[model samples]
Target: MSAPTPQPTALTLHQASRVLEVGFDDGAVFRIPFELMRVYSPSAEVQGHGPGQETLQTGKRDVGISQIELVGHYAVQPSFTDGHDTGLFTWGLLYKLGSEQAELWSRYEQRLAEAGVTRDTPMPAKTGGACASH
Candidate 1:
């Protein structure tokens, strides 16, 4: 017989730390950062309608999770501080994300490099004096 599906036993969002901690029934636990979750959201806005249309997310280094609402027994919908609340994070997808985080993060970084985008927003150049009229 097949093993029973694993479900999250505990889910905690650390607002100050910007991390989501998930404990599963199968004894697996994950601490996922909010920025990573935002960038890797499973929403169509980020994933697109099909393959080869994935949008690379950037400048989300300080993104935070605003709330998490249970979507029946199968998924949890997370609302981000940036007003993104479309993605329904299924148990399977969450598990996969936790398990393959390292590889996925590496690929994301590579994609950002290729797109010339940084996870951090660029700071404005500082000027010593006030701007002059043109």
Candidate 2:
């Protein structure tokens, strides 16, 4: 027998501009901004496993992406300025994070507050990606 395809209850693109509003079957909606997602990629260029290992990204608060290339059907390849062109985003991880965006965002905000880190003044750019916004 053919496997059942997981169907989403609600999924539609916003007609406003260049944004996508994704909704899951669980009545959860996540409106992810394109610029935000681009800046906060979770590749090795941004996150390096532990504290003091992360690379702070700069010039990305309002910076939009030049392009988003899909790396197969499961993940997407994101490129950035300052010549950063690595990092792969899988569909599973995206879905998981998008599902818990609200809670995760709050926790991230709290952590940043504790660290006295502001999104406006991002730390010096390093080797890893910038805190994996996706």
Scored by TM-score, the top model is 1
9-84 per-residue lDDT for model 2 (tens digits): 4434443443435565556666665444544567665676676675544444554445567775556665544445
**lDDT of every model, 2 decimals:** 0.83, 0.55
In model 2, pairs of residues that clash are 40-133, 44-128, 45-128, 45-129, 46-128, 46-129, 46-130
TM-score of each: 0.85, 0.60
* Candidate 1 least-lDDT 10 residues: 123-132
Q: Which stretches of candidate 1 lie over 4 Å from their true place?
A: 1-4, 121-134
RMSD, each candidate, Å? 9.4, 6.3
Those runs of model 2 whose alpha carbons end farther than 4 Å from true positions after fitting are 1-29, 35-40, 49-52, 56-59, 81-83, 125-134
